[model samples]
Target chain A: GAGVSQSPSNKVTEKGKDVELRCDPISGHTALYWYRQSLGQGLEFLIYFQGNSAPDKSGLPSDRFSAERTGGSVSTLTIQRTQQEDSAVYLCASSLRDSSQPQHFGDGTRLSIL
Target chain B: QQQVKQSPQSLIVQKGGIPIINCAYENTAFDYFPWYQQFPGKGPALLIAIRPDVSEKKEGRFTISFNKSAKQFSLHIMDSQPGDSATYFCAAIKGGSYIPTFGRGTSLIVHP
Candidate 1:
């Protein structure tokens, strides 16, 4: 693909339900990242993946938030037991290698927890 | 902890005017700084970036003025246009880390 792609541009779920957001990074890119943007707020880093190494999950807000990158290409972010506070736009990005390189971003999936 | 702080949550300017957005960071370890521009319903796009080694960088109508000692940086848009109305963000990252600390966005509205 020419750029990072994210699935289900919008997702609306009930409280306590689980939701999964997906991302397809640019081909051959070795770095991927996930971020959450609340309404009128700064982007909050959620996770990062570099090649085959263990992902950095230090930014995950809680135990319910988890993510996985499969085959070093597509990635999934799963939020368990959705809450109203979890409503926000989930963005995915990919870079040539790491943070030192500029990242390309997807339009993002707007998650709404009702 | 908010590592990056942006000023003037919003700004309005006439077309052809120059609008400047500022940011400050607390971490001395951050060596890379970048500015992103985002339109409604769109993902952020990298506008310009600067490293601590240089104090300024310019690309087209965009310019970044960085102050390494004060941990401050600014984005100046020359000859602003209505099409340039968007939200701008500032981000900083350490030399070896991939995680960028982002500042709250500044909404810029350029009136025609």
Candidate 2:
């Protein structure tokens, strides 16, 4: 894709249900990131992946949130036992290699937990 | 902890007026500062960026003024327009760090 692509632009689920959000980063880009945006809170870094390096999961809120990148291209974020507080816009971005380069973002998936 | 702190959670400016949003950071290790603009249903797009070495950077109607000594940066929108109304976020990235620390954001409303 010419730019970062995200699947299921919008998702609505009941509390306690699990949800999986997908992101397809730009081709040739080696770095990928996930963030969450809510009303009060700004963009919160959730995870990061660069090549074969170990992803930085330090930002993940809890064990219920997990993400994995496959083939160094597409990535998926899974939220287990979702809570109402999980409602937010999940954004995905890809950069050339690291923070030195600008990150291109997707339209994002708006997750609503009811 | 929030490394970057943004002020004026919300602002209302008349069209053609200049709207300035400010941000401050505590980490001296931060080398890159970038501003992002986001619409209601879209993801944030990079507006402009500045490095600590440079005191200022300008692109079109957007300008970034940096003060390395004070650890502060601000975004100035010249001749603001209604279309420019969006949520603005300021971010700081430290050297060798892949993740950026973003501010809480400011909701700018350009009134016609």
Candidate 3:
């Protein structure tokens, strides 16, 4: 694709349930990132993938958050036992370079945990 | 810990005015500073970026002013327009790290 793509543009899940969000980065981009945006809050780093694998997962809020990428292209973020606080926009971006270049972003999936 | 701090949570500017938003970071290791513009129900897009080596960078109506000594940076939008009304964010990334720290965005309202 010409740009990053995210699936399930909006999702409403019950509290204590689990949800999954998908992201498909640019064709040749080797670096992918996941970020969360809450109301009145800034973009919060969640995790990053470099060629189908993640090297940094420190930003995940808790053990309930997990992500995986396959074929160095498609990525999925899974949240287990969703909480109301998890309601926010989950954004995905990709860059040609690992960490030094500008990133192209997706429209993002707005998750509303009820 | 929040590495970047942004000021003026919201601003209202008349068309043709220049709206300036400021940001400061505590980390000296940051090498790149970029500003992003976001609209309601949309993701943020990169507006402009500046490196620590450069004091300023300009593109079209947007300009970035950098102060390495103070770890401060600012975005200036010249000739602000109603379409320019959106949320703006300042972000910093260390040279070797892929994760960028973002500051709480500033909402800009360019009234006609």
The top-ranked prediction according to TM-score is 1
TM-score of 2: 0.97
**Better model by DockQ: candidate 2 vs candidate 3:** 2
Deviating ranges (above 4 Å) for candidate 3: none
lDDT tens readout by residue for model 2, A4-85: 9998999999999999999999999999999999886789999999999999999899999999999999999999999999
Please list the Cα RMSD from the true structure of every candidate, rounded to 1 decimal place. Answer: 0.7, 0.9, 1.0
lDDT of 1 by residue, A2-74 (tens): 8889999999999999999999999999999999999879999999999999999999999999999999999
Encode model 2's per-residue lDDT on B1-112: one tens digit a residue. Answer: 7889998899999999999999999999999999999998898999899999899999999999999989999999999999999999999988988789999999999999
* Model 1 stretches with alpha carbons more than 4 Å out: none
| TM of each candidate vs. truth | 0.98, 0.97, 0.97
Model 3 residue A31 CA deviation (Å) reads 0.4
Q: lDDT tens digits, residues B4-104, model 1?
A: 99988999999999999999998899999989999998889898999999999999999999988888999999999999999999999998888999999
The interface RMSD value for candidate 1 stands at 0.6
Model 3 per-residue lDDT tens digits across residues B5-105: 99889999999999999999998989988899999988889999999999999999999999999889999999999999999999999988889999999
Q: Positional deviation of B38 in candidate 1, in angstroms?
A: 0.8
Worst 10 residues of 3 chain B by lDDT: B92-101
